[model samples]
Target chain A: MAEEKKRIQAYLEQLKNKVETQENYGGEITNEEARMDIRDCPECGAGRAYHKGLTACAYCGFVFMDTKLTDGVNIRKENNS
Target chain B: MSGNPLLEPIHGITLEDYGAACARLGSGLSEDDVAKALGVELPVWQEANLLWPERMKQDATFHIVTLFGQYFGQADQHPKFSGLKASASPEGAGNIEKIKQDKDFYQELEVARQVAYDYGLDGAQWIVDNYGIPIGDFQIAASLWNDQIHRDIQADYAGYNQRQAAYQAKYQQLFAEKQGGNVADDIEF
Candidate 1:
């Protein structure tokens, strides 16, 4: 029975290790949390808000992303050009 | 932790059935609504609702099986329930060709992808041996899934974090002021 208990403890430790070591694991809860969103231009310190007919930053003309925006259920097909 | 024993089915509602009913409750339906749907009286359903969660707290399998019951519950739905239903407009029906969106396939793919990512080639080899998905296809899906997840996080996280920060800061300030107002009556110095 004690051997089983030891094995279970080892398994629990393994589980704990697996969780704590994950890429997204945050050890502490805080008001200030890490984020991945790039809302501002790194080059010119300008807000990188969306602009119609443009994929780049409006202020600095910095290329934000290369993804092609497509017309959705609500957006018209004419906007795709 | 107090050890929880698995309770026998109350009013012919199996643990899987209870799990499914809990899933229904999770999606905004009330306990009474779930009980009516399960064709059982409220008090019996109430007892079941309490006991099942207690078991889940003790037995890890109970939680996992409950989650599985949430996803797989739709496929293996209880006899009393009328599972998923959808309505389509006639206008789109003629023009739009049907595309298959097999959720189970994607769920399984995700599981395999995570295994492959965590264990590298050995995990991919396991998928190849046990599951029938081609390695190339699995890799491609994993890449696509990662890109999508990254894009989704980028689109939403900052705004969500900002809102959360605002709420927390407000609450913390209030809490600090409240702490200051507390009377220290037990001073024996």
Candidate 2:
């Protein structure tokens, strides 16, 4: 278990360095973090995460890209199984 | 297969629009890749959609629904979709329609419906068969008639192989007739 922890730590460090050095940088610090942010709309507090590139909105019938992620407060712990 | 425009109405989108929609759906693919797969210039595709919207609409919708159902079943399961009417096929009755009434079916069919509209009969069937829908379900059968149509298309391939064998035998007979008394050492094509 200790050896596994050390290996994971080393791997994360490598990922950080790669992200910093890459010229055409994309994605945020971590997918997990970005996913948390995109789970709900940035403007209104709506919970629609997946966008279909359509004009009409399903909830509140809002017709804009203002939808935000909705479940950050209740984020379940990641089971590393 | 169902050429009834009234039953399977066009979405007022041209070939160009259809291509653009397909590109939008295939956001991860490169532009060149899209061109090779769709076989059309971006502008021409747009114009074709504007002109002959009916030509491919039924096929595209069918496909989009299939994709949506697949995506829904495996990845995302939307709870709100349960409220909407689930009947998308003519023969959908009792438990068949009940099965479709679930949110997964709605999501799946939405993806497949677009496919049917864009790729027409073949595309529609491709989505249905790839999704591996069970046979004898009416709503599944109705929304996915292209599956049957596709099987019909494959029948020609099976028929052709059988005919080719018969032709080969006939050719051998003709060769024997031409060289009835020829020695085993003499033969030509």
Instruction: Judging by lDDT against the true structure, name the best candidate.
Output: 1
Predicted candidate 1 versus true structure: per-residue lDDT over B110-163, tens digit per residue: 454454443222444444444434333343233334545566568998864675
| lDDT of predicted model 1 | 0.46
The numbered model that scores best in TM-score is 1
What lDDT score belongs to each candidate, Candidate 1 first? 0.46, 0.36
Q: Model 2, which residues run further than 4 Å from truth?
A: A1-5, A17-81, B2-11, B14-17, B24-189
Model 1 residue B65 CA deviation (Å) reads 3.7
Candidate 2 structure lDDT: 0.36
**What are the per-candidate TM-scores when only chain A is compared?**
0.36, 0.29
**DockQ result, candidate 2:** 0.01
Task: Tell me how far the alpha carbon of residue B28 in candidate 2 is from the true structure, in angstroms, after superposition.
Answer: 8.7
lDDT at position B27, candidate 1: 34
Candidate 1 residue A78 Cα shift, in angstroms, is 71
